[model samples]
Target: MAYLFSGDGGDSDSAVVPLVCLQPFPLLLFASVPVCFILSAALVMMMKVPAFCYWFGCLFCAGMSAEMKAMAMTILYVCCISFLSFSLCIISLLWVFCSVFSAFFLCFFWVLLIVRDCLVFVWGAKIQSETCSLDSP
Candidate 1:
């Protein structure tokens, strides 16, 4: 029993179903984004569990299925989790990078460029000091 509206500005007691509920790809896809993110974050944290217990759960799945449906489902779940977590993490990092870059570009970017130029002038050239001479071989 769902509410259906009539365009005549009147309430009609008719069961007029909307097309969205029938073909829900767009809605489902929108819903899956947050669902996958939450489940993937949980799955990532669950990786801290001991391998012995994790393998035991997987072996239990193997024993439960003749066609390997249970095992396949578990593997699929793991793969989806890994994919979602990595993708969301990457997207968030990129978003942060873009936000920071935009903020700098909006303000203080010229100051940073000036500082870099002053450093270059004093040091003669930009140098790679990643290891700070600790990893020199």
Candidate 2:
């Protein structure tokens, strides 16, 4: 339809497209780095105490009932598994953050190199033209 193409060149209202900025993605990731580290450290520390307790209980609890021992062992195993999983999750987050940060810098440096080359080419041409003109005169 002609209306689709001609309705609002400048004045009439239309749906406005929102600007999406990606500049803050890396900054948000950087802010999360410390949080990931702290969480992983806390989980690791918590895991150590429970794991030591679980082993110690197994070693010394010869008279404990089978059902109670089984329940206790299950609880300890669950705790250890959960702590390890959480620590692994934090480690993976850190890995992702580092990868994204590296990629962002790699792209930024590539763009910088391209712009620098363009500027150098432009200036070199300008200088060469100026010298040629002076030599002719």
Highest TM-score against the true fold, candidate = 2
What Cα-based lDDT does every candidate model obtain? 0.55, 0.59
Model 2 error, position 135 (Å): 0.9
Runs off by more than 4 Å, candidate 1: 1-67, 108-137
Each model's backbone clash number: 0, 0
Candidate 2 per-residue lDDT, tens place, 74-98, comes to: 7766775676677667667766786
lDDT of 1 by residue, 20-80 (tens): 5433444454565687678777665655443433454666653454456545556666876
For residue 4, give model 1's deviation from the true position in Å: 45
Alpha-carbon shift of residue 35 in model 1 (angstroms)? 12
Superposed Cα deviation of residue 75, candidate 2 (Å): 1.3
User: Which pairs, if any, clash in model 2?
Assistant: none
Taking all chains together, the TM-score of candidate 1 against the true structure is: 0.33
Per-model TM against the reference: 0.33, 0.52
Q: Which candidate is the best by lDDT?
A: 2
Q: What would you estimate as the lDDT of candidate 2?
A: 0.59
